[model samples]
Target chain A: MRAEEPRLDAAGALAFKDHLREAVRDAPPRVVLDLGAVDFLDSSGLGAVVAARKFVANGALELAALTPAVARVFRLTRMDSVFTIYPDVPQAIAG
Target chain B: MPRERVRFRADLHAVRDALIQLERGAVLGPLTGESRSVILLVLAEVMNNIAEHAYRGEGGEGSVCLWRKDGAVMARIVDRGLPAPAIPAATDTPNPADLPEGGFGMPLIRVLVRELAQSRRCGCNVMQLCVDDDNAA
Candidate 1:
């Protein structure tokens, strides 16, 4: 799913988690998050991403096309090494 | 640097807006893309840590005083919440096979700022953060 916001704060993060949880409930074996437009991500936002990861099926969650800002959050927290990140949505879909 | 203190609620948007305004008020060369990112990430993590741990998720009112001094952006944040821990140690990253969530706030803040001092005075959490202007990503 593509995020449409410039910043994803606490409230937005929780809402994203809920949406992802619901999506995971009925999603395919693989779920990819398209964070192309999100420019600002905080700890709460990262937490939401992790929560979503835990909720999805094993080896199912993927993140694609992260802007530099969003990518930094994951990298700084060492989460970039944890999540299955893709260069873009197309590759994620293909893989 | 202003002698006057600028205060804002401890909510996410409020803190973020305040930081943006502070950045605009500075006359120095705009922070590099990496520097700006580090500053924002640090502030956001600290603020959320305050909201979650200090205020028990209430996100109570907090105050921020920012000024440019000696080519550094210095800030004193005061929150009417519990005393902050001496240092919120970074937890070990979970194994890839069993990744965990919700433990990156303190670690991120500790890494981004040049200096961080957290203390509890008068039953409040007082934190001082110093970010050098010349710092790069």
Candidate 2:
């Protein structure tokens, strides 16, 4: 999953949710969300990530290449504990 | 002291533009990139909350003010729509893959900002948010 732009706020979040939903529709067991390009994240963006995980059963959603800004959100929310995070896509894919 | 402030309608369409202007204001303030990131996140959550609950699609009913004091970035946002709700207490993000789809705004605001005060005064909802930047001089 590649986030298209820098800021992911309420306006951008809906499209993000739709994108993730499309990925989840016929996704495999392991899913890696590539967030290297996203520079900012809001609650709506975070909710979409969680919602995408819900849409995919068995907790298949994994996060990769979190920028400092994005990483702080998951850390502040303590969401880092919930998902498998990798430093980059290659690491996540290697697993 | 540099001028740092923003004003916008309480419309969903305005949120993105307002945030962009707010970011420009934040860059001129006494904040580092990291501190500005925190401020940006708080603004996104709170401003959208106003659009969803306070304005309820009624544009121009909400306004925001920002300033720097004692190394802390402060914001006071006012809205003439629905009364603001109490920010929820944060707990550990629930595990077990129980991913939530909604209602993550308030939690993010509380965790990111240091001084947050919300109240209803004279039929208007006022929210005061502050995030301290240690590197500010």
Candidate 3:
């Protein structure tokens, strides 16, 4: 699922979490979140992404297409090492 | 550029809007993309800290004043809410293998800004952040 919004900050973190929960209810074996269009991601958003991983208990939560700003959050927090990051959705899905 | 100020409510939504306004303003508008992102990230962390911790997730009024001079962008955020924790010189990076859900804000702020100072004055929390021109570092 791609994040349509330009920003995934504190204001949108909770809603994003809720949406992710709903999206994976059927428990797919893997979920790849495409964040190509997301220009910004604050710590709250990063936290939401981390929390979303827990919801996919039976599956994996992978991230794709991190824009520079979003990538910065993941890198600085060392979350880049935590999530399976891919250059794009196709690569993430290919894995 | 001259100092620019934005008054906003201490809520996530308002904070986001305030950032948009500031980013488009004179102080930040002409910065390199890398520099702009650094300034925005640091300010967002500081403001969100005020909204989430100081305001206890409740809404309150606050202001962000910004100035770009001396080869740096300086920001001062003021809010009338509970005081925040001390601004540590360094913060530990949470182990990602633990899948920690939170605690990235302070460390992000610490790494992105050139200088940070937090203090409470007359029942208000004031946070000052300085991002150098060569923020690409």
- The model with the greatest lDDT is 3
Misplaced by over 4 Å in model 1 are B1-5, B16-29, B88-97, B134-137
Model 2 complex DockQ against the native: 0.54
TM-score of chain A of each: 0.91, 0.93, 0.94
Judge candidate 1 at residue B109 and give its lDDT. 73
Q: What is the TM-score of each candidate against the true structure?
A: 0.84, 0.88, 0.95
- Model 3 interface RMSD, in angstroms? 1.1
Order of the predicted models by lDDT, top scorer first:
3, 2, 1
lDDT of each: 0.74, 0.77, 0.88
Q: lDDT tens string, model 2, B1-137?
A: 45455777787668878877877774334467788888878887888888877777666557778887878787888878788787765634444345566655666676667777888999988888788885221
TM-score for the A chain of candidate 2: 0.93
**Which ten contiguous residues of candidate 3 chain B have the minimum total lDDT?**
B128-137
Q: Which docking category, incorrect, acceptable, medium or high, applies to candidate 2?
A: medium
Each candidate's fnat, in order?
Answer: 0.53, 0.69, 0.76
**Prediction 1 global C-alpha lDDT:** 0.74
lDDT of 1 by residue, B27-126 (tens): 3226666566666677777776676677886668887776667867777888988887776544454443456666667777776678888888888889
Q: List the residue pairs that clash in candidate 2.
A: none
Q: Each model: TM-score of chain B?
A: 0.76, 0.83, 0.95
2 versus 3: better TM-score goes to = 3
The full ranking of all candidates by DockQ, starting with the best, is 3, 2, 1
